[model samples]
Target chain A: MDRGRLALSLIALAAALALPFVAGPFWTGLATQMYIFGLLALSVDLLLGHAGLFSLTHASFFAVSAYTVAILQVRYAVPTTLAAPAGILAGTLLAAVFGISVRTRGVYFILITIALGYVVWGVAHRWSSFTGGDNGVTNVPFPAIGGVGITSHTQYYYLVLAVILLCALGYRVLIRSPFGLGLRGIKASETRMQSLGYRTSAHLYAAFVLSGALASLAGVLYVYYNRFVNPVASSFPISVEAALMAIVGGSGTIIGPFLGAGVVLGLRNWVSSFFEMHHAIMGAVFIATVLWAPDGLVGIAARLRARFSRPKEPGP
Target chain B: MTQLAIEVGALAKVFGGLAAVDGVSLSVPAGERRVLIGPNGAGKTTLFHCITGTLKPTRGSVRLFGRDVTRDPEHRRTALGMGRTFQITNVFPDLTLLENMTLAIVGTDRRKWVMHRAVAAFADVRRQALEGLEAVGLAGRAAQPVKLVSYGERRQLELALALNTRPKVLFLDEPCAGLSPSERQRISKMIAGLPRDITLVMIEHDMDVALGLADRVTVLHQGRVILEGTPDEVRANAEVREVYFGHG
Candidate 1:
């Protein structure tokens, strides 16, 4: 809403619109992946950044939705309209059940989510007949509604960009709402919040379900784009990485998670080309981020902006 | 006869083997300013917690306006017209003072659940929040985060938060615990200025502030009320002097 943010957003939008035309297919594909993973991270942050809940079971919802869409589309020939909504619903229902994790806090919440994630991953991996085992459901066609079909990756890229933009706008509105402020209040002090007539646990549970639903939405987008699904989508690593992307980018802000996704996925793609142990570099990045820039890239940028701009402003 | 705003019968709170609040009974009438005073470890705060529903009593009952509410949760008690300020100044540190007030204003009402619209869009909430701040002499610091404000200001905001909940019975747990003398006077003045319709229950270590504000005083020693009377009677009691003043 500020002039600086508006200008920056317009520039980012123009670049996103032009990337498919200007860049190669590989770059466009990578950018699309960034947006998808970015959405996943954003979902994690809805709890992590605002409500002070660090969830690691988000991959369960993501993968559950992805598997649902993949199986419905590939095995049963379900249309995108039904398959997509069904995927999101399955994931969200799972979230509603998994949402009981709100009963625990701190490391216990993380451990429970990790355990729940493995349950989903285990089913996806061990249940060979239904889930296609390790290979997962494959040959899923691109999302098509009615007569209009996404015939090319480039066309799908635009669809994803539009969805993410709309989601970001909604997320912005949500964080500014009274419910959003209540989440921040809980984050600050749950005891005080309870005394203020807030049912803190219920507030947190609602946020968890909503975050899971958003992550499920991302899963739908991902399955359509990747054209397949696998147990890796449900694995613990994916959940950790989604959370890490939010942290490395800026856990609280909208653009921070996307920026983090870009850094992470971009690093992995570029590093894995030559280095066999690229994960070490990722670990180092996380450690350095935690040690020096705990607020992520957004915090660093904010500090830099303040440093440079404060000198020019008149005394308060 | 005046109605009792708060009634506690045979209340006791035990933590493991220790009874923090051992078998205490208290009744405060509507529109009375009742102050609970004692030496350290006398269970004043523990008693407040049980009455406010922050901690469940091991045995006994708490009633508000003749309605038994011992089974209710803290928020439910708050909804039932009970509000309290913490001794250690509990508040939302990251939120602006106005936002803090807004939470309190909407807390007891259904409006706290409104999610679609931004908080600022609620013009009435904003106006009420400002008025709440103004009442606590914090209107100038409305835009500042609670963390950035002085401790004295946070204490005021703490009282402001409780007041905005619109409780019929208000509890203050050492509201001026760590304030300067001037700050203490300001807070006591705010407490004194509150309408007589709002029943006040306070715990104060400062005897001057305690006696000046109380319609009646209850003296506690070792988790039991040793004496209860007017300020003059409490001050002149030989047992109070022997136990409270540490001399016969």
Candidate 2:
């Protein structure tokens, strides 16, 4: 961390802290969504960027956790304390089962996760008796403890900010850890990792489960913020969008996913205001990203910085 | 009586209808430098894979230090004191040499599972990685990524990765493959200098390095062991000259 970067980071942090006051409620709300979804993208990157696994079933965990929190809180009148943890546990358990997808690789891996995700979406969409189907479980209240409760969306935004910030800090330590490096090694070459004494499958399974747990946490936050849970939360596009967010922002870095979330969500809001084929615009953006900036906006920024920083040689 | 370091009993690996390793069996005693030399397509690497648990044999079992490990996976074999280098260089190209060595150092132990602490914080692991790199003459290039190093350096990193795991039975699959003559001598000297307590199983195409380092030689042709004897005997055998030298 250089002085320049540190100063820049502090400025960014200050801006984020002062955003709700400076900007109107709309921008605050959108920023909040960006942070929440950014966390989901970060979770996906744990496997995608590090372990070299491309899982499309992450939304299953996200929705399962969200639905659990919604139903428990809204229907059974469970407190946020129990419901949130329970939601995370439920999502993590599903991830553990889904982690078996690590047994396959390449196209087979992608296919299995897609199929698994569809099963969850199908249950949420078709199982009307318990799941409440398309309408889903609604009127979920804001999280409230014994004495303290978040009464408004603005306060909830701050809460989301605080939680994601802590998560980001923790994630920084984690990615720099030996286990994290092991994941990178596996990504570079799994066969070599195995010969080097790593059970590549087991490392991947653990990463999958951990990634799912993070997504589950995001889901709990989403449920509280949106005040509802729907089948759309578990849909395939959400999973795809999450992966895209990580890729667009930078798959391997912390700020990259959040930055990518801002790009995607902000682009949608801005473009859909007047554009009829807003999704088409998104498709084009993704295409451009893959063709020119495969490492995401973060990588592009790095290239620019390097180019500018290098001193020019004297004339021949 | 010499203790058996590795015992492959009737090992076979078949790819569809083709038996790449067709019922090959070997017994290398502890503290012996056993080299396997054979022509291309003789299933030398396949046999090495089976013995190192890279590929499972369709029949027979592999044992390490008299323990049944045929069912064990590659990582488990490494944990049970078996380590190997690939015939083709297989170091992690994206990782720094230090990180590569760090992985090999912590691989067999519980430290590899520690997720909370950054790798840089482990001073002892870093020290050991540097020392291990020094052993392979790679200490100066510790911070460099494998991709930046020359192919010869990558080969040395390959051997370093295996040695850091602290294996009792070491397998080097053409460890000197694709190197200059001087580089070949450097690697062969490294192999020959290894402690005799560690069982050495190597596959080499260079007859000079192979015979010079080997206490005994095993010759394979058409996926079967054709000769297993002392280096002098293997060099003298007319059948070997006919097959290995292609004089027949």
Candidate 3:
């Protein structure tokens, strides 16, 4: 990584680590929520930005993990830690299976993923005996590491931050790896990659599994933080929010989605405090951002910096 | 009598009602440099696609290194020591020239799945990629994004990508299409300098280029091979002269 990028990453990490100390209870809770959403947004960006796969079913995997944790802890008497891995495993496996069928290019893939999301939502909603149907799974417990339990809001906030940081680092490493290059190769030209001896489907499937696993991890954190899981967790609006965060942050950069999550979630909290129509405000912001900053906020900033910086001559 | 690098026996490909490639049979011996020349709609590109496994033959078989590769996918074919370049320049425009060649080398490498390992960590891959770029004279432009390079350079990058795979048989589709006269001469020289062990099969529109580079030339007309001989024999053939080489 270049010096500028390294500096930016360290600064962002520092800000995140310092947020809990300065913010109040309500603000801290919101910030924690944003961090979880940031993880989800980043996972979505892996598929959309890196793999060039537009998936609308990511929230399905999220809700699957959330509901898995809820059902295992509340209904089956399983501990939260064991149940968290189980949920993530289920979500990853399901996403991998769906990826096989949904790996087609263009709008077909998007539609298939959307249909898969609806199918997951329908099952969760209809299976009332296990999922509690529309009421959702409730009384989910805080995650614990052996004897050290996340009991308070502050402790839970730190826990979410730790997981987010670890996952983000893993994402960074994965995106810079050979597998990541293969995905980018697929994105650039699937035919060319195929001609170069890469099975593009295998790369896409791996990306789908990784994205699903990350989304599931976020879902597990979300359920633990909120102490509840609802059908709305798998709703289209949640998926839209994840996509919007990714797009608004600049999908080209790995950290853009997380940055976008912070800004969008912060704005939502600010707007909802004064207005009854939070959705309308968010919708307006989405429209405006797409129009004015199609490359996203990071792209806009990069453009400005480039405009003011000293120009370099073209290379030989 | 030398081992055949590629052998096509009665290959045919039909798209809906039209036969894109029809009963085409040809053999390219190992270490041979051959050219396929035909006017537009002679199925030159279609034959290249079939050989590379992009389009499966409706009948007959394609053998690479005497092994039947008719059922393999394009990637499998590439892994089986057949490399191809598109008629239109195909390169990662967003990536640097070095990165583009590195990606090709990485693809050909067996250890491509180990995530988090720096691609440059492998000294051999880096060396091979640089060597491939040097072969096409793009070594100095290594760090420049392919999009920043001129059109001729992009073509060279495409050749570098194909060469990076270290294929036994290299198939180039119109490698000199859209180059200036000087650029064409440079590419012709580069092609002529390739290792003798690497069999070169190319589609060329320019008769002078075909005559200069190819040890053997095959002319395709209406999806079938009309003539196959030495460049002099092909140039002297009455049918080839009348159907293809005649002035418009």
Candidate 4:
């Protein structure tokens, strides 16, 4: 990272560390949700921004993992150590199956993922015997490992903040890796990549699976934070919202998704309090974003910086 | 006896009712520079595509160094020492020229699967990518995005990308198709300077560039080889003149 970016990151870290103490429980709670969903959006961007695959079934992985943890911990009395990995494993396995959708490109890939997502949603919504119907697996306790445990929301916020920071750092490394470069090349021209000796389908499938695994991680953080795994967690809007967050923040950058999640969740929370149809306002904002700021907030920031810092030149 | 680097027997490709390549048979000896010349719709590209495993032929076999690879996928063929440049310039526009070259360098190896370390950590790949770019006269433009470079430079990078794949048999599809005379000379000089140990199969519209680099030339008319001979023999053939250059 450049010195400026490093400084910015340190300041952001300090602010995040102090948020719960200064802002109270509500803001801490909201900030916690932002980090979780931001991780989810970061996963979606792995394919969307890097590999150029638009997947609509991330919610499937997210919710499946959440439900797995909720069921294992609540009903079976499983410890956090086993249940968390189990949730990630279940979600990742589903992603492997859904990874077959990579065979089709463009609209077909989108359609297949949507259909697959609906299958998961239908099971979560209608499977009352095991999934607890619409009420879902509830009264889930905060994640506790052996004697050390999270006692309150403020403490949990710090844990989440730590996890997200680690994830962002790891994500930074992954994107700059050789494997990551191959994904970007595939995005530019699959034919060229194939001729360059890459199995484009295999590359895309691997990316899809990894992306699903990340979404699954976010889902684990979420159920513990929200204290339940409902059908809404697996709904289509959740997947769409995750993608929208990535786009609205800056699809390719690490911090962009987190910033986007803050904008989206903050707006929804503030708008819904006064207006009955806040969804319409959200819709308008998204349309405006697409029309005028297609590159999202980060792109806008870059443009503004370039404009302001451009050197003056003499003209005839 | 000279070994055959590439052998194709009765190759045919049919798209709907039209046969793009029909009953084409060819054999190129190892380390020989061969050029295919034909009119616009003479199935030269289709033939190249079938041989390189880009498009599966409807019928016939393709053998590389005595091994049949008719059913192998494109990347598999690339692994088996086949590399090709597209007729059109195809490259990673968003990535820097060095990044594009790096992808080509690690593409045929296990390093492409290495995700833990950054690409810059591979000092050897960086050096080789720079060397590859330098060979193509694009070393100075390594940090520039391919989109920002000149079209002629992209053509050069396209060839560089193919060379970095370590192909024993290099297929060049109109390597100088859209270059100015000087740019064409530069690309052709690069092709001519390539080590003769690597087999070259090229499609060219410019007869001067084609005949100058080709050890032998094959003329195709209506999806079949009309004549195969030395550059001088092809130039002297009346049949090639009638079909390739239109009527007298």
Task: Find the number of clashing residue pairs for candidate 3.
Answer: 0
| Model 2 agreement with the true structure over A231-296: per-residue lDDT tens digits | 999999999999999999998999999999999999999999999899998898899999999999
Q: For residues B1-248, could you state the per-residue lDDT of candidate 3 as single tens digits?
A: 79999999999989999998899999999999999998898999999999999888888899998899999999999998999999988888888887788789878766568676766676887787788888888889988988899999999988888887879999999999999999999998898998999999999998899889999999999899999999999988899887896652
As a whole number from 0 to 100, the lDDT of residue B27 in candidate 2 is 95
Tens-digit lDDT track of model 2 for B1-248: 99999999998889999988888889999999999999999999999999888888999899999999999999999999999999899888888999999999999898889899989999999999999999989999999999999999999999999999999999999999999999999999999999989999999999999999999999999889999999999989999999999885
**lDDT score, candidate 2, position B150:** 99
lDDT of 3 by residue, A100-197 (tens): 75458889988888888888889888988878899999888888767878889998988888888788778877877778878888888888888888
Candidates 1 and 4, the one with greater DockQ: 4
**DockQ of the candidate models in sequence:** 0.85, 0.85, 0.74, 0.92
Worst 10 residues of 2 chain A by lDDT: A188-197
Better of 2 and 4 by lDDT: 4
Best by TM-score: 4
Q: After superposing candidate 3, which stretches have Cα over 4 Å from the reference? A: A2-4, A274-276, A311-316
* Model 2 CA deviation exceeding 4 Å by range: none
Ranking of all predicted structures according to TM-score, beginning with the best and ending with the worst: 4, 2, 1, 3
Which regions of candidate 1 deviate over 4 angstroms?
Answer: A312-316
Error of 1 at A150 (Å): 0.5
Residue pairs in steric clash, candidate 1? none
List the pairs of residues colliding in candidate 3: none
Give the per-residue Cα lDDT of candidate 1 at A94.
97
lDDT of 4 by residue, B1-248 (tens): 89999999999999999999999999999999999999999999999999998899999999999999999999999999999999999999999999999999999999999988999999999999999999999999999998899999999999999999999999999999889999999999999999999999999999999999999999998899999999999999999999987875
lDDT of 2 at B203: 96
lDDT (CA) for every model shown? 0.94, 0.94, 0.87, 0.95
Which residue pairs overlap in candidate 2's backbone?
none
